[model samples]
Target: MGGGEPGLGSAEVVQQPEQADAGSPAAGRLGLEPLPYVVGEDGAKQPVPGALSIFLRSGTAAAMCLDSLAAAQPGAPPFLRIPKEKLLADIQLQGAISDFHPIKDAIRAADCDALAVRPNLDDAYGDGNNYEVACSRAAAEAWQAVEEWRRAAAAEAEAAASAAAAQAALPKSKRRRAPQPWVDQGTEAEMEAVAGPPPRPPALLVLERPLRDLVASRQRHQRAQQQQQQPPQDQGKPASTQPQQQQQQQQQQQQQRAPRLVDVDASDLWSSAQSECRPFKDPNYDTRRARREAGAQAVPRLAEKGVQV
Candidate 1:
């Protein structure tokens, strides 16, 4: 037909479909042994296994079998084939899966046919066998417990406060009384009661002038006698000598009696006198004074007699 295409036109491609071997290891492990086909409600032939069919019939049985399988093979995917009726019964008996509302709602939503509808006609008519009633009862019990705890705590707090106030209010000692004013009235009355009538104050005795002059004269005579008994100093001294000295001493005493100025050198006079009267070099100088004076007097006599002076 076309130029130089004789062999190309004669060569036709042959095709063959690839088939999986039933004796392969994957097939044997997966138990993919040509599942018994069944016609579904839609009139389609679907693969159905005996084990899967049994699991669908009994949820508890399916769960047990899956648990055993998972234990045997650690890396196996989880199997979920619980029957609707068993799951609903479990949900009713066990209550909500968790306290979270959203999780319960999601579970209800996902398993609507099993969980959303009432268990029986009585529950649907609101005969009080629902999850809400159980949750409400639990809440009421919790609130009651809370109120009891609060009341107990308040009572305890009040008791403690009252005890503290009582302790604070108690007097420290038994001798509690108001302070009394200091007065002699109480003391005077008490003394008068114990000692009978009060004693009279002594009368002022007015002495006559003559008796008063007589008492003065007796005092003067007694002072004169005292002066006579005292030893007298020499009176034979010249008036210019001893009398002047006495007058000078009297004047000096009178000057000393005058009020002292604050900035006086009284301490300097005492210190200077102390320095002048230094103790003798010989400690026994006072004891040896008699012998020394006697020896000196004898020396004068000996010198008069032409002995070695």
Candidate 2:
């Protein structure tokens, strides 16, 4: 009778139904799925493999790629809806929405034309495959960046280790330690001692109090007397012209203070060339010609006749 009623059923029957497979979409959609598991050696259920265990493995790389793509997108309340047609197309594609890890040359054949366009958050939030496609492109870029960084870090570490090994293989005499510049470790007191007590601060000289007071009083008295004497003369003159008169007086005083240039008779310049100036003589005409003539006269010419014995 309970089963016959329109919707009513036995409480036991309502409560219990054949459970769906844990990994199946139906189970996930209905919230009936247990946490993912695998059978262990003992036939006991074990938790599914972690990201780190599966990330590098070729077998699980596509799954990891999908997971990253999903994670890159906003989670569903308004569910992430990919159209059935687009889903079928993605399945037909070689690498689907995203290329798998250590992406092979074969995977490049898959039409990833969507990746060519920059991913936009607005498009990702729109209806249909836009969300998945944008997320896949973005996640792929992020994965590539991480992979490149990992490789670079690994290479640097390997190079450093090899360098260290090579250095260790060298003989002690051949090995050079990295140079360290000298750093001052002297304490303030030690430094002061080395510098000989800062030149005794030049022995500050303090003026006696009585002398300071006397000097200050004299200055004040002089200022008072000057001020008293200056006003009567100032009353006779216009205030504006006083500055001009003062400037003129200063100019005149400056002229008077200038050093005088005294005029005197200067002696004629003493020069060897001027003192020895006489009528110019040509040595060739005077000494050389005379010597040549005398030498010519002194030399006897040989006659046509034979010389006397």
Candidate 3:
């Protein structure tokens, strides 16, 4: 016979025993006495030999045993020991060959070297009998992918949480208070009273021209007083009190005409000389100069101008 249909090979078919004469050795081995044989299906007297008889029993038993074994192996194809009777009944009633194919393929694909059957079934089939061996492999790979994704996501979340916790744990630095507007409005001496002594004044305020000039003038006066005590080298005539008094009056008049000093604190001055002062220009300078040269005593002078000084 040509190698029967793809799955129904010669090796798979159960062999029947031959009918023989009574008392023959084959009949004795079979534990049956072969008499006159009728070939028709209804009237046939079939004699099965011992080897074939054993094979048939073992084959049917194998199918039943597979079901129990398949249960033990979770990843196995789901069609191990499906009841042949039920399979036949389903085929007869439903005539669904597509359902039968997957079950058969699952069983055939199972590794014979495996220690136990693997009864992995597809979710598409409500009954475990419709097993999909390939689908089980695919599902396992998909599950692994899902597990890897979950692990990565969990690690990322842990790292993010740790970073947040670290940030929370750090001590916060104290913020400096903003400088008050009133603090900017005063002299160094006044601000010193408010702020208390240690820092001194800002450099700009401490080095102002007016305060610096006062310091220099005090030093010059001290030097002059020290020089006066030294003896003169040449003999000189004694000055007359009458001329000295007249000269003293002239000096007083000059002193009275000099510009009066206005007090400006260190805080109001700029740091550099260029920034501190600009040359003054009088708007009425030509007229004032002409009037003064003409010996005019009263030239209708402008009123005093008030400045921040």
Candidate 4:
């Protein structure tokens, strides 16, 4: 084939020969991966090499074709092991080949089912491809659950901090406790054994005198006083008998009464001189000689005027 551009009806335009410099691992695994073939105006298959670049840009049509070919031809080349149903979904979504009327005529002519195509994920983003790999449903759901749990944990921590702040804002209690006196274990045990304080003595027992003895002494004194204050009473009598009775009564009264102290008058001048009372002195006291003989003067009488004897 010449370097000149191929006619629109040639199948060789979409066929690719492998190139090590292309840097596609999938292409390296097999020969070169071809683009989709276009249809000519005469209902002939015409390969368009530009279809591969288009599939790489918009969707996974190249990967779908490679995977389907690998399934159909097990001995062919390396491709991703995607499920058959996923492959059909890729084929159905990728291009709707019927939209390209020329391609639709060519596919219908070959009796091909466009709905049965599948794609390999590796071929889409593997090697030099910069596309992000897609995750499965279960994996995505698990990541979402992890994110939710993390948020819940953060919320719980925030709630705990807020509750602590609120608790700290409350007023402290003002109640104070009475100081307890310290006691040794031995002393406390003894106190408990005794139960309470000792019993008190009775009031009667506490008195200095007996109750009966006090009452008897009080009654006797009252009777003696009453007898002394009263006057004597008598029946009618003769004069002599009355006089004798009166004399006897007088004698009895005189005997009962105590003698009164009387002082005799020493003013007769003939009476003998009475001795003066001596002053009392302490036996243990020592007196000075000058003070002991004080006031000891002799009495003197003057001589008579007519005779001096």
RMSD of each predicted structure: 41.5, 39.6, 30.9, 41.5
- Pairs in clash, predicted candidate 4: 64-118, 87-117, 87-118
lDDT of 1 at 151: 46
lDDT, candidate 4, 181-280, per-residue tens = 4545586578568865436532322224455554565555455456567676446665668877788679757845845322212332232346454444
Off by over 4 Å in 1: 1-138, 161-165, 172-309
Model 3 is weakest, by summed lDDT over 10 consecutive residues, at 47-56
The candidate maximizing TM-score is: 2
Query: Candidate 2 regions off by >4 Å?
Result: 1-139, 179-189, 198-309
Model 3 agreement with the true structure over 33-152: per-residue lDDT tens digits: 222111223433221110000011223335435554334453433233233444445335545333333244333443332212223223121222312222233323433443354444
TM-score of 4: 0.17
Q: Per-residue CA lDDT of candidate 2, range 1-309, in tens?
A: 000111122121111124444443344344442222233454443222210011122223343233344334443121122333343344456453332222222233333433311222233212212221212333345334433544444465577578778888999998757545455566655855775433343444443345555456556545544543653344578889999878866875685586633221122234566676444443432121121112112234476442222
TM-scores of the candidates are: 0.18, 0.24, 0.23, 0.17
**Considering only N, C-alpha and C atoms within 3 Å, which residue pairs clash in candidate 1?**
none
lDDT of 1 by residue, 1-309 (tens): 001111111222211112224543333343232211233454443222111111111243344244443243434322323334544455466564312222233333342232211011122213232111111222223334433544444465576567667766877774334334454547657855796543664444543345555455556555545644766454777766887767866775675576643322233235554675543355432231122212111122233222221
Error of 3 at 281 (Å): 22
Error (Å) of candidate 3 at residue 300 is 59
**lDDT at 215 for candidate 3?**
61
Q: Give the TM-score of candidate 2.
A: 0.24
Clashes of each: 0, 0, 6, 3
Best by lDDT: 4
